[model samples]
Target chain A: MGLVGNVCVVGLGLIGGSVLRAAAGAGHSVWGTTASAADASAAAADGFDVGTDAAAALRRAAERDALVVLAVPLPSVGDVLRLVTEHAPGCRLTDVVSVKEPVAEAVRRFAPSARYVGGHPMAGTSASGWAAGSAGLFADAAWVVAAEDGGDPSVLREVTALALDCGAHVVPATAAEHDAAVARISHLPHVLAAVLAAVGADGGPLALALAAGSFGDGTRVAGSRVELVRAMCEGNRSALLDAVDDALGRLGAARGSLASTGSLGKTLEAGHAGRLALTEQRAAARTPLRIDLTAPDAMAALRALGSRGGRITALDGAVALAETT
Target chain B: MGLVGNVCVVGLGLIGGSVLRAAAGAGHSVWGTTASAADASAAAADGFDVGTDAAAALRRAAERDALVVLAVPLPSVGDVLRLVTEHAPGCRLTDVVSVKEPVAEAVRRFAPSARYVGGHPMAGTSASGWAAGSAGLFADAAWVVAAEDGGDPSVLREVTALALDCGAHVVPATAAEHDAAVARISHLPHVLAAVLAAVGADGGPLALALAAGSFGDGTRVAGSRVELVRAMCEGNRSALLDAVDDALGRLGAARGSLASTGSLGKTLEAGHAGRLALTEQRAAARTPLRIDLTAPDAMAALRALGSRGGRITALDGAVALAETT
Candidate 1:
């Protein structure tokens, strides 16, 4: 991966910290800016070249023609863009916001001199902060390299190279396309999970004790950070609302069929087929022979199985291994 | 574990097969009734005393004053109740149906002399059938033993004892309570997962590939056998509808709050709190110090960790050892 020089990363939160770490590990000099002095100290302790003055950091990086990554949340995108345009006049700009279309528009108006590519790495955990960041956080995950129609080609290339060097599969798309897709796949699911969980909570203590399997899995994202999810939903309000309406439409059909077995079964039948179609596209759907790692002494048994040859990904009640080519 | 002589298990599916195997391994004679000759032959091959004639098997068990477990699905419950009432008149009858109130009412109407206890063992996998059954399936799981007010105390005691012998924790509850709890926790989640999957499928192939983390998990139950889920939903219709409507009400509020930061953040804030409340109830909620097992060759690392002594559950990306007293 060829970079013009070093990189400038702002925000110093989980996403930005991870990007700084990954870039540094890839042998690219990274200058990080934190919103607070404590965050600056923590990042510096983590071996990052850090500062609290984002404008000064961007100016320094832009002098060397560095890529300035705005790894802040959606609410701060416009302010960050303004800072980048003022200090890093001709620098290549990229972002890690969940919603892309609004950022693209913001970039168009606020960062006129900067060549901008809106990007989002589709990987995260419930945990946040600089301490939670890892260099390998983006490994094997999708990084949407969302570009506008008239951006500098070299800037897009450099951003894509940076993402790939971080070990992400760069998905090329327009900002609108990325926004529409994430609204359906990411933002909508998070909000719905929260709703499902709130509903379960309303059922009282007995319902909580009995919650497992589908309930546990369905509401998994309800525990995500409120500020992050709220930003995602509010930023992409139209698309998120559209996705929710689509889901509620399907749910309404299922509800309508409640009184009739034939109709209810038909809804389930469609659902089953739809699930199969969607899941079959993913590589994880391949039925790896289950390694019975369910014993209480499961770790010992897994060792015995692994000695024979298998690649285990997730182990709960059982171990599932993807067959190596 | 004291039993009333031996046990008779009807229907040789995953649940029944597991029960039969477990009861037999615990030194009890288990006579099983299968719906088909192939099923009977398969059970016999597994060292079970199996037959295709349901009435004959029930009569034999009743004559010997045995505990007769009806481990069939919901649709077969009424027919099985008729058979037990006719042939196994005074037997202590219990069932493993997902719903309970209907069974309790059916027992009152159809099998007056047969002492009935409604039971549901809360354990399963994506797999089904006798081939997928294990003697330890019910181990460390909840087995709800629901008995009506007028049932003989001895019958409830025997049923609870059998659940214990099969390595389950017996949860004493009324049929209506069991049904309502299950509707919120189990049935409603399955239907909602299906709806979510169907909506994603409507988003087309791009959305499918982009679906990861919560999306994959939230829709995991969509792959469940359709008839089983349909039966679950239809059998507990009113309760399931109540749960769905409750979820919709929460979702509607979230929808209305899309424009305001205060309201949107409040929805997510409530969701975060709800998820914590629901998950904190489980013993698994305690954050045991994580033993990193992300290395492909992780078992060796686990063996070293195991030597330190604690309860080791399953190992995947990490070996989580809960601290012991």
Candidate 2:
């Protein structure tokens, strides 16, 4: 792939549509397709090059050696990968699916010949569809790019460049690690939100009326599309199960303490410390670092930086400019 | 008590400071005392009647036959009640403490002669101290007023009028019922947030870095002051324990489905339905009603309306103007 290749996005929903807009805004030749005729029409009406044919889009991407992004939801990943296999057998590929390991698995199973690099831009709104997307959706967001052992550096560079161009910093991790981390930070929260919402609602209208900021903020995401939430959560089932177990264990301990001792001191203190850590991390002074992409241990360095909460701010030729807090 | 009686607020923290501001804004005779010298000076500098002596404040409240508002935290309630007993025995009383049952119990044990009515305004920020408060804090908020059997109608009317004058709609409930409802809506969310925050932090810095809107919103209240959170959660131990058990049950079911069937469909769907219920309740059309405070069954009517989520929007002479959605 060239330093800045043409971009082809499959699915013109929120993430995909935003990718098309952002890539084009970054000066890449960009186009996308969607199964939803409404999304296609919306994108087309907005003067974007969006179509309703996945095969045709993949064929054109193959001809142009474009970086094909699977921006579809988890349920649609396999079918799109099949199309990629038939139309562009070994195209430079990446994705913006929420769960990383599952998408990576799908790509390996259906389009093994593709030079794939798994990615997930950690950004979205509760809204969906083409009309709900914008060029700035990913600005200043963390975009996770998988750093598998023995992975091709060239394809990784291609993915990193795309993410950086779309106005996001890169966070490198293995697909498994990405899945595990997100299960705690993303998927488990979704499940908990659902539970909290249901429980709050069960308190009848009085409880709902008494609900204030905490309830409103805690259950805000429960208002997201249910099927979409279920798809991402279930897609990362193993990792999410572990997170759920950890949460339940903590909750059980809290309940035991409250019942027997009338104190939630330990639980509240731990949570307070955790929140303080987050605040400190966000407010910490960042130190700049650069990794030469052509170096023998470039992938290792990238993964190490990401594991320590570092971000690749830009791709400077074969070097990745990064910062660590 | 006069129709617009004097309001004496002890413990000038966020809620107390706001009460002073709002009551004064509503043209009530207001005065407050705080243990924190900094808060006392700050409130005094703001041209409000603030002091540091609780006994002196209570003595003046006794002289004026004021409606005393104990806005102290749960752990301090007993100490403040002892002072109230010595200085203002049988004076009109209420409180803005988060937990209702504990405060009521304290009142019964320490100052049983005080004409007591329990209250809790369902409004707050994650901030504490006088500087963090404002007159508009309770605007359009639900201020719960306990409607116990054979409770004094005059005392309830004074509290109701104060809440309405402060720009809050009054929600009448039995103290025990209020505690149970808040456990589900207010206290459980705090525990869950703490658990969620701690779990996310356990994923290491990478997880925190990737924490987006969902994680942030879900754990927002975990950032609240740990001591304050502990006091309220521990204060309502029984009801919060039940709520915690309910949450754990739902979480266990979610985990089971994920482990065996790789689906969170039921949990997500229930959450969606719960969120929909909240939306519908907020959007439901309202019907106006009024209860004669002098009537024999006024307390029953008020409690019944409150149990159904009805709110007293205004006090018209001897009547409570309310609405049910």
Candidate 3:
């Protein structure tokens, strides 16, 4: 209900398309833009006011007090930023890019006048294009929001509200922390799938025919497009590489101790415990309260909320909240 | 329809319970034996004739012209084989163990007089125990069967017939071939999941909370009980270690190529192609014809069955068949 203005989503990819569908259904005035004329026309056919010119769309959206979302690939963020600065100087900007630090850096360098926030919704189906997206794509998914240094608080609030409007659970994080975390969880796993499948290629026809369940599930993400893999790996290069090293080190230790059944069993038992923790984390839910507070008043706000069982989560530099039972 | 008379399923674990359910539904008088008294009682509660004494069950089943399936853990295969030889002498025996070569070796060493055929039903749910099984668990799943050296041809045919009666896609493979194939597809994925989860243990709360569909699915098998993991790794030690080396080599190559965008993209692309091939393999199916032909008559069998567009699949060295479109 806090998101009162018009919305502009500047890509017709899966994430952008899903946001458009959800925002429009939530009664926000939604506008969409894509590089392809066919996609723009398709969006128009679907009853959204869509175009291929992102800047022009953002400019018109700015006049209506819109939140302009940059949903293109990572490399295109700088270009989208430049266009927004040139055409829609004072508008609020956010993005759906997977990696955040680089986008935040770009926002600081190119879009000085615009209010900018970097965001990523950890949600997608196997399919990529707009046709594969639906209004339910972001429902119950973790959506991270990262504010650029000295960015407007109102802009971050509006972006978080937009994520909430799409039925996502907002998880506020610094750009640096987000990049590092995803490098471990998302990026590394994609590479792991590729590694698993690469090995499976040597297995011949029998292996291919017998690979069911876990094999299919484990290697599912290796089927991701090259562009996406490139963007994710190159975008979070150091962290991704570090995570890979951590994995190989663990596996190497297991390999060294493989002949020792006791050691191998211990390592596997630890993994079972780790998987249990992951399952528990996914199942746990918290009711969140978005409250305005300065650093001095944050503890007081948290204390007023509860001390028995809850966590303090920062929304931005100036606001904090409680995630509670 | 080829499976006649009584059936006995030893162990009453996931595979054994499912076999009992399916065989009983297929109009066979089924008996079940489990090491755990609770499991035997539970199977009996499910309307099955069940007991804790596996040897007694097999001995009784042997007198009734039964097809006896050993569905115990991998290490117990040799002991189960010995029991079959001692108590159920000359009975038709098969197993649902994951590893085949070891089971075949055990049959030769301990159950030389028992008519033994090694089998593995490529079907299971995440849950174990008799409580988690259904009558339709093996429906349309790959069921690999391997014959012991100098085993009766009639025994192999009867086991394959039982697999078909359980609504499985019968895929006959040698013990050596089956062990190698499963080491790559099934066993390796389990260890891969374990390795991935081991690395994930080093990641903090943020990474775990944000992990969604792919991470969960990729590591699902890591949650398997440690006993099973130990049994699998130990029983198929050599092939599993080889698969691990192959995967490590592939991942090391990717890590080495991380600095080269072109190389990284190509590796990911190959993985994509591999995954597509796997998907196609899973989706592709055909009805098969069991054609009896000697080694000398193989070419004639192939010629007569040919050009009609089907694959030639060997059946236990004594016969060959066509898996037709």
DockQ of each: 0.24, 0.84, 0.43
Docking band of candidate 1: acceptable
**TM agreement with the true structure for every prediction:** 0.85, 0.96, 0.87
Q: Considering only N, C-alpha and C atoms within 3 Å, which residue pairs clash in candidate 3? A: none
**Which lDDT tens digits does candidate 1 get at residues A153-272?**
556556766786787755555677667777777887887788778777766555665566888998889888887787777889878778777777777777777855434786787778
Q: Which residue runs of candidate 3 sit more than 4 Å off their true CA positions?
A: A1-3, A27-32, A61-65, A129-132, A147-151, A285-290, A293-325, B1-3, B29-32, B45-47, B58-66, B147-149, B260-263, B285-288, B293-325
- Tens-place lDDT per residue, model 1, B1-325, is 3533589999888899899998888788789998868778988997779999999999898888889998888777778889988899888888887888887778778887887877888888777788878899988777776644555556665676677778875555567767777887788788778877777777665566567797788888989998778777788987787777777776667777774443467667777887887766664433354444334433333323222222233222223333321
Tell me the TM-score that candidate 2 gets on chain A alone.
Answer: 0.97
- Clashing pairs in model 2? none
**TM-score for chain A, prediction 3:** 0.87
Candidate 3 DockQ category? acceptable
DockQ order of candidates, top first? 2, 3, 1
- Model 2: DockQ vs. true structure: 0.84
Alpha-carbon shift of residue B2 in model 3 (angstroms): 3.2
For model 1 chain B, the run of ten residues with the poorest summed lDDT: B306-315
> What are the runs in model 2 whose C-alpha is more than 4 Å off?
A1-3
lDDT for every model? 0.73, 0.90, 0.76
Question: Residue-wise lDDT of candidate 2 within B44-94, one digit each (tens)?
Answer: 999999899999999999999999999988888899999999999989999
**Candidate 3, residue B64: lDDT:** 85
